[model samples]
Target: MPLASQPAGRRERNKQQKLDRITAAARELFAERGVDEVTTQEIADKADIGAGTLFLYAKTKGELLLLVQNSTYADALAQGKSEAASLADLLDAVMAILRPVVECNRKQIDNGRTYLREIIFGDPEEPHHRDAIGMTVQTEKAIAEVLQRDERVSADDAATLAHIVSAIMFVSMAATINIAKPVDEIVAEIKDQVRVLLPK
Candidate 1:
């Protein structure tokens, strides 16, 4: 068989190895120092990659955060969807979907705030910003799928509902944290506000 016909395991492994090196270096540095304090050159040196190469993975420190949080966010979304699958009600499904988001944000609330600010208000010209936008859209699509499972919600309506629900959850979580409100109160208040937006 030709080399072209072979499985791409080697290629994939190499890519994974590089990514692992970068992520491992980032984890150690970010943990020991913190995001704001860690310089890109330091991370690049630790990863054994050139400074220019590091930018290929993440253009800015905030984007580097997006890179680090990528796996965690994906895992949270996966778990949220899985749990939401067990519940039939729209509200329950929505809450299940967002609960993980809240928990993930709480992991490093300072980073969370910066992450939100950068992604939410970032320039669209940046690649990482585009990725963040894409992630949000995908999350909303997942929510729409759940809501659409209900007979009462038309396919078209589901998209709108998902947008509303996602925005509500996003804003709610940010507010709850910033105001020093009891974190425990977020879920209940979100449920109330969502119920208000979507009358049952």
Candidate 2:
């Protein structure tokens, strides 16, 4: 029988199981050792799968990195969109999304700060590396549409504002939260900044 003719249910189940295992393992490894330090073989070992299985799920470590980044971004934005009203409301929306992610994975985030920093401020040419660039553009465009509806900003200005907000979010993620200056205080500061930026 040809591969296409073979039963798909079992294959699908096995594929899902493998994906679950890999994703779980990657989360654990990322939480424990950070993203840069983890290798595909190590991830496979943690997931109890072969190196080949790792590639089946993610073609490269970069793809897996993108997966993690996108998931985090999507969750933040979804939460933000649901909760925001004004620009300050939007800041609160963003902070709500970020606080938990940062608190839960503070160590991992600190460890991976360099990678996150590079992602935000590094060369624009890096987007040529993957489809994330396009996805990011889409996200910014969506935000721009929202802004255009609420304010008098031009389309280009709206998109640029979205990018600036995105940059601020990145900076917040990179910051260290401590007793001297708590996350709430930082968030309030961000909210104040947004108020200044948004038109009356």
Model 2: how far is 179 from its true place, Å? 14
Q: What digit string (tens of lDDT, one per residue) describes model 2 on residues 1-200?
A: 99888777987889888887887887777767777788989989989999987887777665565545555555655555555434444445445544443443244554346445545544454432244455456556655656676557888887787787656645665665532455566566555665566656
- After TM-score superposition, the amount by which residue 71's alpha carbon in candidate 2 deviates from its true location, in angstroms, is 2.3
| C-alpha positional error of residue 187 in candidate 2 after TM-score superposition, expressed in Å | 2.9
Tell me the deviation in Å of residue 194 in model 2: 2.9
Clashes of 2: 0
Give candidate 1's error at residue 33 in angstroms.
4.4
Q: Cα lDDT for residue 134, model 1?
A: 77
Task: Please report the candidate that would top lDDT against the real structure.
Answer: 1
lDDT score for candidate 2 against the true structure: 0.61
The reply for model 1, stretches above 4 Å from the true place, is: 1-5, 9-15, 31-33, 176-183
